[model samples]
Target: MRYLTRGLFWIAVYLGLALFPCLALLSGNMPPGYGYWWDFSLALGYGSASMMAIMFFLTARFKRPALPFGVDVIYYFHKYIALLLFLIVAAHPAILLATEPVVREMLKPAQINRYMAAGVVSFLLLTLIVVSSLWRKQLNIPYDTWRLIHALLAIAAFILALIHIEGAGYYINTPGKRLIWPLIMVCWLLIQLYVRLIRPLRLLSTPYRVKEVIKESDEVYTLVVEPRQHEIPAYKPGQFAWLTMFYSPFSMKEHPFSFSSNPEQKGELRFTIKELGDFTKRIKEAGPGQTVYIDGPYGAFTIDRHPAERGSVFIAGGIGIAPLRSMLRALADRKDQRPHILFFADKSLEKMTFYEELKALPDQLNLQVVFLPQHPPANWPGETGYLNREILTRHLPAHLSELDYFICGPAPLMDMAEKELHAMGVPLQNLHSELFDFV
Candidate 1:
């Protein structure tokens, strides 16, 4: 209920920001309406620009704004909101082109004004951002290069949009009306200041050094780090952080990973990473005493968030077990005797990342470990293939609907498990999943 209030508050704040400029258009001494469709299109242009401006704030990683909704949830919002605003922005001009014949004349290469060209270029840049982001892998654009390009293009598109607006001198013709945009410009510049310069400078002052790298299994490794300047801040068991190892924090090449170690142990952080790609594969080369920058501990997929009077259920696949391991280890360290169950899915017995440690954990806490190895030996007695409704029901506590479910893994597994659990009467709020593939 408290989270709901915070969530609603943030939503209200977001709506207020998105609608502020549009609302200002209704203020004192307004311009005469050109036409219904024409004025409506202009309103959309103002609203879309304001929404785009706020996107910078949304992705700034501000802890307070992100706490109500987890960082992952906020990012998902950012992606969808970008999609919605793109359509609105495109519609803003489409309506004008259709309703005002003068707009069609402005598009000719021989007679386009500078302001019209600015608007056209801004729209093109925005389209490129959307297309490249959605099909980045298909187009084979490098992720780090995309990040840098995404930032620069978004900034340029927004500035050009502001130019397009001010140069027209339509609604914001008067001095009082013109004041609003300068205010927005100040806010935009401040956001850029914090994201590009101030935050990176702060991260530079407090660096974390790699303590060691432990090989977890065939392809997974745990890179441990301890702060050089001061102890790291406390974070929930299943929280995650963005680590910059090879480059400075300003490089924009950092990768996000879950906290594999329990926060019960102070002054150290562990990230269990898989050799999945170029950025992660570099973890194998991380040596002791290497300097690294951390920018998080943001997420909401922990056992600590929900009450587990009758215990809880955890579902993981492959390296998704990272956050679950943190929760289990933290619970064991605290000696929580409540009944807890884990359904871990992997390729085979040898391929499970935390096979031995999970097997050993039941002795320390009242925990049930269910391993679903895809390829089994001769007469495997345990579950296999994938997590389904039957597997969940067979092992889940009798009070199925009362327990909290924490699931993280491949998209297919998480999607299936969430659907199956909800169908089997688990409350929607009782099921928690974090979508961290931020590509």
Candidate 2:
């Protein structure tokens, strides 16, 4: 019922955005239409512009608004929806140019007006934003730098698009319609201030200090930080937080990591990070007393949300076991008697993280661990090779389809596991996965 309410809320929000321009147009006198295509172009332009404005709201990380749907899903929506809306915005101009000779004439450099020029520049900036994001890894753009660029480009494009719309003066001719654009602009500005200034200020006031950094494996390390002044809120197992180390909260250089620590342990937070990205690679060098800022407890992957789940199946690869470990520890602390199954995979036994801790879990809770190594030791007796249908079917309980499957790992592994789970007749709602790679 909670999930349904959230879904419905988001649907209503989208419907409101889509119909905003139409509502404004109807509220007051509308200017003369340039036939069907031109009028259609204007409607599309307004709708797409509205979408662009709301993109900021979606990514702003407002806790209450994001509580319904995980922030991770919001980001994925922001990414794909940006692309779709960009196409719609692009079509706004394309239809005008293709159908109207006046628009084609206005496109010429010598004859272009300021309004036309603004629209052109806005389109170009939007194109750059999309291309850079889609090819950031290939283009070798640093995550921090790319994020800064993305924000700036989005702001500039939205501003220029608004200018183009106001100057074009077609649908927004009346006093009420004119007031609407500025009101929307103010709302966007407020959201930007909250995201960029206010939230960072709050984070700065409540800082955390690194108590220790423990090496979990050759490539994975556990960072332990405790609140310096204020007590942090308790996060659910399987949720993640953004860590800003050796930088100010306003620096925008944070990286997301799962809370590997038992949330039952208050005042202290733990993140098990692997040497993967540029930021994570430096985690090994981090020492005690380093001040860090955290901005989360976000994500909908927690088992606590599904209180009725009798059993859970956790599938993890490499460092993806971080969140699952938190859940297991929480269950153990509660002395949970529910059946729990874990399939933890790594390249070899030596590479598996928290080996001793995981081995001791069965004694604490009704748990079973299945360790799969890509390259097993000569005398190894457990399952070997990648996760496949045969391995899952053989080990999964007879009530496999009824169990909640929590999968986390590299993208490819998660994809394969989800496919296999579906193939084995698990319902979609029962299969949960977190895509933590948010830019």
Candidate 3:
């Protein structure tokens, strides 16, 4: 409840920031209207710029403000909002071009001015951002390259929009209004500083040394690390961190991975990563004594967040089992007596990460392991084929509404489980998931 309150407070603050610029423009001496459409276009322009500035704060990893909704959730919201906000931005010019003959003339090479050019370029950059992000995989753009491009384009668009607005000199004509506008822009600049400059600098102070790397399965490897100069940051079992290694913190080459080891142990940390991306493909090359900088302990997909009154259930597909391993290990260390059930979907027993430990976990805690291998060997006793509604009904216990359920893995699997479980009488609040695809 406290987290929810704080979350609501931050949202209110965001609303104020987004709406303040429009209010400032209107609060000043009013200018004679050219028409309703012309004034409406200007209003859209101001609102879109204000929203663009706020984008930095959304992705800044404001850990406390993001407690009620996880950073993962915010990242997804950022994606959604970016798309919506871009439409507003596009409408600003579009409405003007359609309704105002003067706007069309200004775009001509003969009449184009610096201010008009800025607005044009800003809109183009915003278009690029949306296209690159929404279809990154289809475009075959490298992840790090795309991030650098995205940040640079975003900053340029915001600054250009501000320049275009200030140059036009429409509504914010009074001295006080002019002063307030610059201050708001400056505040937005500070947020950008913290996100791109200051935060990375802070991460440099704390570092970890890679202890060893162990291949957990055919497609997964666990990288073990211990704190080098400072104590390990306290973290919940199903949390993740952004790791920068083999490259400077300024490189923007960081990737997020869940804590696969037991959080109860403080001496060392472990991250079990799959060979899926450019970063993870190189995990096998990470040797001992390499420096690593971690920037998190974020996400809200842990059993520790709520009291599991009627036990818990975990549904995992492929690499999604990393965070669940952390929770299971923590429960074993604490000697938790509540009933626990795990439905792990994988290709085969040999391909599953932590196969040995999972088989051994039932003895330490009140846990049951149910493997759903897609390709089972002859005479295999466990369930085979993909995880779907029928298999879920067969394994899941009665009174589903009372138990807490954590589902992670591929996007499709999570989507299916979330929908199916909710339809099967599970309350929305009882289901939790970690969405790494957004990250």
Provide the lDDT at 249 for model 1. Answer: 88
**Model 2 TM-score (2 dp):** 0.98
1 or 3: which has the higher TM-score? 1
Q: Report lDDT (CA) for all predictions.
A: 0.91, 0.89, 0.88
Model 3 clash number: 0
Worst 10 residues of 2 by lDDT: 25-34
TM-score against native, each model: 0.98, 0.98, 0.97
Q: Candidate 3: which stretches are off by over 4 Å?
A: none
Give a tens-digit lDDT track for model 1, residues 96-200.
Answer: 999999888877899888998899999999999999999999999998899999999999999999999888647886687798788899999999999989989
Report the alpha-carbon TM-score of model 3 versus the true structure: 0.97
Among all windows of 10 consecutive residues in model 1, the one with the lowest summed lDDT is: 168-177
Backbone clash pairs in model 2 (N, Cα, C under 3 Å; residues 3+ apart or in different chains), count:
0
Model 1 lDDT, full chain set: 0.91
Once all C-alphas are superposed, what RMSD does model 3 give against the true structure? Answer: 1.4
